[model samples]
Target: MVRKAVLPVAGWGTRFLPATKAMPKEMFPIIDKPVIQFIVEECLEAGIENIIFVTGRHKRPIEHHFDINTDLEKHLEHAGKTEILRNIFHISRIINPIYIRQKEQLGLGHAVLVAEPVVGNEPFVVALGDVIVKDEKNVVERMIEVYQRFGKSVIAVFEVSPKEVSQYGIVSCRHIERDIYILDDLVEKPHPDEAPSNLAIVGRYLFTPTIFEKLKVTPPGKGGELQLTDAMRLVLEEEAIYAIKIKAKVYDTGTPLGYIRTLVEFALQREDLKEPLLDFLKDLLSRDIPQIHRT
Candidate 1:
């Protein structure tokens, strides 16, 4: 059983700039809860117990988020906010949190490699810190089912546009059965004309410990970083790797635009905010706004 999950949040977040200078991008909120919190909740919901974080120097907030904040808990209890206090207690108690600081920001593949000691020889899930899937269907659970059936590592992929192929790692695979693919190759950020297929690798991955050995030999590729796609391609050589086409809407919260869009979509999903937010959006869109120049 896949009982552990690795979250890689060591990126510098240059995409979010000054705000990220003081904060990790994963700490950004979807609503009241931060993005990392949502990711942890998702993992826990999927039966993941040992929540491991491949973090950096700037990611202490993540550690603190899962850890106990006694004073805050006491204050909330004193204020008679039992519901909020229970939520805090749940966050601290439910997760088996382990944090390993990556000495330097190498790459996603390197981050997962450093987690080898904690992961041991078992299979684990690698869920990207920035991507959130509002999956009512429990996507991780589905991936686990696929793993049990095929006895091969699973990669979550979704179809992307031809123009967007350059932004992702495209996979070449043969359709095995409904939603399953036997991967043949992985090309990281290929040109539109050069892309093998539109099936882009999404944030979620399930892998055997064999990936660590492959990652060891996986040299730095684009941006002079150890590309996970390069290592995954090596895995394809040894055995068949499977892909599950995710049917849920995947949210990428790594950039400013993606972050804001995720925020709006999540807000729309809430019961209290749905009607008011929809009305606010409708009212805002119905008018012609005057452009204001920056001072």
Candidate 2:
């Protein structure tokens, strides 16, 4: 069983620029909660008991979010905000959180490698901090289901347009059955024509402890960073790696556009803000004069 999860939060959010200079991208608000919170919630929902966060120097807030704020708790109790107190206490109970720093700005593959000491010889899930999966069922839960049935490593897959395949890790799946597929191979950022399949590997991953050994052999790729995808490709030769189509609308908040979109989408789902948010969007669209009009 995948009882532990590793989240790599050490990446520099250069895409977000000045805003990220002072704040971590994982802490960016998605409607009401931060992005990392969503990822943590996913792990908790999937029965993960331990969360290993491979964080960097500036990621104290991420750790703080998981720690119990005794002063705030006392205040909440004094103020008699029972509901708010319960909510705060609930986050503290989710998992046994552990944090480790990845000293170098290595790639995703290296980030996962840093957690090897803690992960030991158990299967664990690696969840990217900035990706939120809002689905009919929990994305982690879906991957866990595949892991249980196949007794092997699994990667969450989603169908992306051919044009967008180059921006993601594309996979070739032999067959599909109710959101699960048997992965033949994975090609990271392949050209559209060369792409084996349109199914792209999403952020969620279930891997056996052996991946650390494979990652050691995996060479650095584009930008001299050790990509997790490269490591998985090597492991595929010896182990069964499956892909499950996640039943969720994934939002990549690592980039500005995706970050803004998540805010809009999540805001639209909020009961109190939906009406106002809709009206605001309608007003903005109605007032925009630069849009090319069709006769």
Candidate 3:
């Protein structure tokens, strides 16, 4: 069973400026819960016992959110908010997370390396905190299933438009079945025409301990920071690495525009706010402003 999982939250979210200047992007909410919470729930559902968080400075809020607040708990109990108190208790009882600071702004491979002391020789899952994907069967659970069946490393993949292949790590694979591929090669951020295949590796992975060895040999690529894709390429030669196309909508909530769209989607799904939000939109669209008004 995959008992340990790692989440990297140390990146400077420069894309979501101003607001993210002080706030960690992982805490950005989707519906009523933060994106990281969703990622944690997915891990828990997959029987993950220990959550190793690779964090950095300015990420104290993420730690606080997972810590116990005696004062707040007492106050809630005194106020007689029984239901709310229970919810707080539930949140407080979540599996305690282990935090490791990554002082340097290295790449994703480096972030995974920080947890080496804790992960040691165990096969673990790495879920990117900023990318949120939801499905009926937890994404981690699905990945775990594939890992057990093949007894090898597995990565979550999605088919992206050929034109947008440069935005993700493209996977080249041999067809085994519908939505399942035998990964042959991986290329990070390849141009549209230069891509190996249309299958894009998303932000979730199930990796074997041997991956650490490959990551150690993989040199820094395009950026000074080591790219995880480079490490995966080296390991692919020895053991099997496969990709599973998940049945979920993935939200790239790390960007301002993506964040705004996620907020709107969540708001419109609420029963209490749907009518008011629709009415407001209708009013704005009915305005006398000219169609050519760019603003």
Which RMSD does model 2 reach against the true structure? 1.8
253, model 3: CA deviation in Å?
Answer: 0.5
Task: Note the residue pairs that clash in candidate 1.
Answer: none
Hey, what RMSD does candidate 1 come out at? 2.7
Task: Please report, in order, the local distance difference test score of every candidate based on alpha carbons.
Answer: 0.90, 0.88, 0.86
lDDT head-to-head 1 vs 2, winner: 1
Clash count list over all predictions? 0, 0, 0
Residue pair clashes in candidate 2: none
Query: Which candidate leads in lDDT?
Result: 1
Tens-digit per-residue lDDT, 245-272, candidate 3? 8767778888888888878877898999
* Segments in model 1 whose C-alpha atoms lie over 4 Å from true places: 290-295
Model 1, range 196-252, lDDT digits (tens) per residue? 999998888999988999999998987888889889989888988999987788888
Flag regions of model 2 displaced more than 4 Å: 288-295
The alpha-carbon deviation from the true structure for residue 264 of candidate 1, after best TM-score superposition, in angstroms, is 0.7
